[model samples]
Target chain A: MKKKHIYIYSPSSAVRDKAAYRRGIQRLQALGHEVEVDEAALSTYQRFAGDDRTRVAALSRAAASRADVALISRGGYGLTRILDAIPCKAIAKAIERGTEFVGLSDFTALQCALFAKTGAVSWSGPALGEDFGAEDGPDEIMEACFDDLLQGQGEGTGWRVPPREAEMLAGFRGLHGATLWGGNLCVLTSLLGTPYFPAVDKGVLFLEDVNEHPYRIERMLDQLRHAGVLARQKAVLLGHFTGTRKLPHDRGFDMRTVADRLRGLIKAPVLTGLPFGHVPTKVLLPVGAKVEVAADGRDVFMVWGHRHAPGHRAH
Target chain B: MKKKHIYIYSPSSAVRDKAAYRRGIQRLQALGHEVEVDEAALSTYQRFAGDDRTRVAALSRAAASRADVALISRGGYGLTRILDAIPCKAIAKAIERGTEFVGLSDFTALQCALFAKTGAVSWSGPALGEDFGAEDGPDEIMEACFDDLLQGQGEGTGWRVPPREAEMLAGFRGLHGATLWGGNLCVLTSLLGTPYFPAVDKGVLFLEDVNEHPYRIERMLDQLRHAGVLARQKAVLLGHFTGTRKLPHDRGFDMRTVADRLRGLIKAPVLTGLPFGHVPTKVLLPVGAKVEVAADGRDVFMVWGHRHAPGHRAH
Candidate 1:
């Protein structure tokens, strides 16, 4: 395993679980990686990691760090409101110089905005605390994927669709050179009308959310469809939509119902069962990369080629 | 009160409470309004009042009924998905002929789309079951507002801002002839980037929601702000945002903080305490009407003038 430089910062909520954060940093250090934490990583203002100005400055510091990876401490309720103040160009410059900007949930706002403004790529992957600092330690698969990223060995990712969905996958001709974009559904949908929302037509859009009811999920998808977004996509990928509360009034409606309904509405094939979202056993996905996706039986493969090489610089 | 014809239909979710539906009808009859229920009002398909086609036809029937008003049976998780299939032009035509189409929550989608497509006005008000059919009887203020709509005497509506917010309301110079719009914040935000979203400039945007946390509410408002929607508005009126769950992790963040932050962000005044939303005390406000708004101490008044007159409709 290659030892790498990792810069950890908080651009979202305040760290409510300090123990988890500490464990995460310790875990990364144990893996022989040099981890640097931002000065304002633990700062709090209201429910945010810091005030808008503070968070913006923290981002600037991360971009300037020039580390192997710039990872979020955690994602919560921030970023969306301070989008205009974000330093997208500097972050894009950092990415161009090989800094792998990475995070999920609220981080989707920054990723989508940077892509929209500067066509910069970021990673929709684990947060330090939640994924790495879990009481039982990080999932082995997640760690392996992270290691692949650190070693510059990640070329693609694959997962199997449910048995009942295999037939639908068999009919999919797959897509080539499509932009792989999207992270948290709620965050992405929140950017729909904003300039921050990326325009990636013929792209493969993957989405996941937590705690949102099936109706709200369907509503967000409908918003995408109504905005002519779904029609322009080559395919729509579904990650794990976890923590959805099932109500008796929902009758038979669930994520499956939402997916099935989406399939019926758009020309794009709606593929489900992606290994990602607010779950621990998640895969790292390139947010702004052009990728090829193909399916054989129920197994789906997405390839983006080698993005970085080992011993990628910086002091 | 002048007896008026009322056309009741279900264009969104299915009526889960049959007893409430019966009571609502009976209540309307007792009020001397001749209530004519659409044949498919009680029909159910999954969680919807009916399937998309069925609901669309129901909307058509309501439009063609030529009744004094068209009221929804209830509101639930529907409408946003069926925007494209809705009979907007027909409903707009009905509005021109003085059939005041009215509903809220999920109905915000139809109201917004109609205004966007044809500059037609609808009502951001109560549904039959939830408002008129309460077990303890209807709220007097709500019933009075409905009577005013029926008698074509509704000139405007007013409410007193919370004392903590009174000074801020006092500073408001108010708006003149600004387009009055917005309803059900989530539904309104859902239409943000779509063609169905109204392009109302210098509009008095009134927003409300139920079951959304303060963070979520602020996020939606942020989306509106980021999309340049809030900057385009003359003033922002916040109606009742109820049913928000209290989370200990919120750390003092709530609707009050959300409103305060909004007031600081936008040049327009963020006025709260509008008598509307999922609550029983809601007042009917014309969705797309040109109106004047003025603040007097704690009391804020909005005037849309007389939209309809009594004893002049079809049988």
Candidate 2:
């Protein structure tokens, strides 16, 4: 095990708190690791990382070049605006040199594209402006990710997911393991048909989203179902689908209806209400790990391990 | 002009309401046209048109074979599920016989697919469920759409749209006379890189969506922006993007900011807050009609037709 450096990036235009972003840097620094902050990469406007494409692009390239790991400053809106401006080839070349990129929410597009173009392993985890920036989430979760990156430590299992009513099984069959993929549902859906969305066949699919109504959420699930993404997965794991409310005059449609529609449409075993998304408590999910989503009694557990490595499969 | 027969068809799951499905039948009948409710074509399930490949495929083929003008029952989801199951060649053969089709919302998938696969003159417009079954829109709108379909009655000159203090663009140049094509933003984005989205290199793109938070809405816009869909347009016409406080925690995103984003991203002239979507007062916008977006006057006016078509462009 060796020390790893993580780079941070942003793709959304929603205004972020400066103090919060700094706190994330401090938290990571306290864990006895080298930390770097390039102000040039921070968003200047309410939602943009920065309007200056050169600064955004240069910081993106520099972060990749300098780090063993790359993280997003935050997720909102703006990456699609600056992605072409960023040096994709150089970023890809840097990943080949061993830097892993990660973050979630609006940053999903960038992670997907990075994986698509460079095959770099990307995780949908805490961003400085989003997750770690907040006062919530246990310090242990952050430590968990950090330890996993370096030393590959704290790799335990039998993780408990909530609602416990999630389904599984369509293209999914007896005991197959592959890398976990996907991020915020809204962001992942945006990359539909784009070169970014990797093939999900025989892969475990994970999704989460914030502030989408039941019908809109249902429609997105419909989009994935119709596109054959949901049906092709070996198993479906859902995180948070927040902000669903029933309108007074609009009782005909709601989030539960959406959940039901998804259950009906997708033959794959679908699970709901996983503790992730725009919530306080979050789980550190490694995207490119050999993880097992096995059924244990009435509950299902997602376990990860390093093959043939010491302390592997501790769960 | 003689009234034309419009058949209702939705293969795969029926995402629309049965009442609306029935209402569409009644509306066309009330307008003095031959309307038939084929029970076999109707989906028994509330949310789904049908289940299983065999049933959906049979229903789709039979409906396509019998219909003159197929007014899609509604577009909530399902077409793509049974797309490969249906006989594309037969549908193409039916389109060759000059059978027209129209629907918007989730229906965009079917419309785009049929058009791409068979060259059908499919359109994005009022769905049978939300538009017709509910007895809820302005009488004028219903009259306008029906007349346009039945008699080819053109709409009147530059109609005034209601004003909102949205993100206004300075130096908004006037653009007149461009073909209109597009519907829900979510639907259109889904059609990206798909066969259904027409090449509108210099055409006006009309868009609307319901129940999407500002962030999600912005992301869809970003998808269109990054894909260069917006830059290719001659002018951008925004329809109603309804904001609802369904969830207690849901703070609606500003549509004005959306307009501002479009202004910043699109080189083409962009306008906002048109009355068209899940609203009481909706404008019947022909998905493929020539219209004028004039910014030279005190307000933004969308003028379509030869100036006497009973249609007034919303300002």
Candidate 3:
């Protein structure tokens, strides 16, 4: 694959680990990709990467750079502050020029805003310091999957979970051409009732989060279900949910119990074991792309682009 | 005040402190109010006061009982799960028959749902175990405020904050007849984009929470602001926000900073020092009531029902 120009910028929280960020940039360069760092990428203003104006300006500049990809430096808690001021048109124009913007966690605000405002797709996988800058380097699966996505060679991706759970996904066997949407659950729920909320119809919605307890997760899923967002979806995919600490009040309920309750409440099939979210070995997924999803025994496949025609059926 | 029958029930979390709950009921009985406890109020069902069906049955029975006041036994995390099964019409009919449903915290979901579905007014105040059953007994201020509201004598309630913050509320001096709405901030945000969200125009929206850090609080406030709820409000009243642990990453930006930032973003005056929420010394507030509010120097007053004209202004 040809070397791609990767533009790195910070649109969320302040980066406290300058050395790790530097190491991430070096790793990208070593991988034969040209890197361009935004002026405010390393600047700190309070708890943010920069003040609202600086973050907005940095995002606008990165959007107009037209690089092969715009990768976020890190995720924290800042993007929602400057979401209204983001230059959505410029980002859409950048997408038109083949620039793929990518990040997860707090970046979900930006990606959802872009999709809501312009119907443009963004990547929901990996980050600079969080993924690529790992002490032992990026996880092999993440690195290979990201590279394949960037080179436009990954027509489809598949993952296998424990065979015991195969029956849970059997209901989604022939689903096809469902628009895959959603990111961090908390971020997505934050945008509800706002203009920045995406109104995807009959889509395959995927969600994952970190550090949130099972009750909190159930509350968010309840919110989406109450909002009629889940009822309109063709399928609901569950990814990784890590870093949750069990509270004494939780009784016997956990993430699995939350997932089971959600499956019982919503019309769409809820299937687990998606290789995505705040984990090291995450899959790179297109946020607003139309994709075909099918579950066969313990294996699930999600394919986009030329791999399958729109609404293609699987026997 | 004449003797009024008060029906106590649990529509959310199970009663972990059985003695405390019993003590609360005894206290109400000692106050000369006829107290009737629901059959399932003490029954436990895995973190809930009872199963979903049991909770819904209790709520429906409470509403149909036509008791003068339907007070929730406690607040935890069950109401949201049974919102659809709630008999809003029966609850509204009970209200018409002089029943006043009351509770806070998780009860916000039930209150908001009732208001949205039937325009029914509920109480945003104390609960059994948390307030009346306190080790030292019910707080004097809470008992007094609740008595005033229950006897129809609380046409107006007044409270004082630090004189230094009086100027912050000065903008609301001329505002009158603003529909007083809102409960727990998280619960209110959870109902966003749902049919159960009350559309109160030009209202006085109040919010309070417990255990949420400033950033989370700010995000929810931002969601409301972005959804156009704040801009349309006559004033935004803030109650207690306590029990949040300061993390090393806060960098000195706390709840005060969040309130300050919010004050600058929306057009409505953001006033603090409301005697409500999870705190012990709180005033009983009439949810969905149209009230006249004004800031008089260091003192703030809220008056409802026959005490003021629709657009009464403060001199």
Residue B314, model 2, lDDT: 17
lDDT of 3 by residue, B111-160 (tens): 88999898888889899888999988899999887887667566767777
Q: What is the alpha-carbon lDDT of model 3 when measured against the actual structure? A: 0.85
What is every candidate's C-alpha DockQ against the true complex, given to 2 decimals? 0.82, 0.19, 0.64
Q: lDDT per residue, candidate 2, A1-315, as tens digits?
A: 454565555545533577777777776666555666555556465445556464566446654556756766767666655555555567666655555556678767766676666655555676765566676633566556656755545352343444435234323343457567778887777877555666657677778888775655665676677667777776667787777665443436566556665777666677665556776556666655556776654455666664225543121
The candidate that achieves the highest TM-score relative to the unseen native structure? 1
* DockQ-best of 2 and 3: 3
* Candidate 2 chain B minimal-lDDT segment of 10 residues: B306-315
Give the CA lDDT, 0 to 100, for residue B67 in model 2. Answer: 53
lDDT of 2: 0.61
Root-mean-square deviation of candidate 3: 4.6
Candidate structures ordered by TM-score, highest first: 1, 3, 2
Q: What is the lDDT of residue B17 in candidate 1?
A: 94
Query: TM-score of model 1 relative to the true fold?
Result: 0.98
Provide candidate 1's TM-score on chain A: 0.98
Best by lDDT: 1
RMSD of every prediction? 1.5, 7.2, 4.6
Worst 10 residues of 1 chain A by lDDT: A306-315
Model 2 chain A weakest 10-residue run by lDDT = A306-315
Q: How would you order the candidates by DockQ, starting with the best?
A: 1, 3, 2
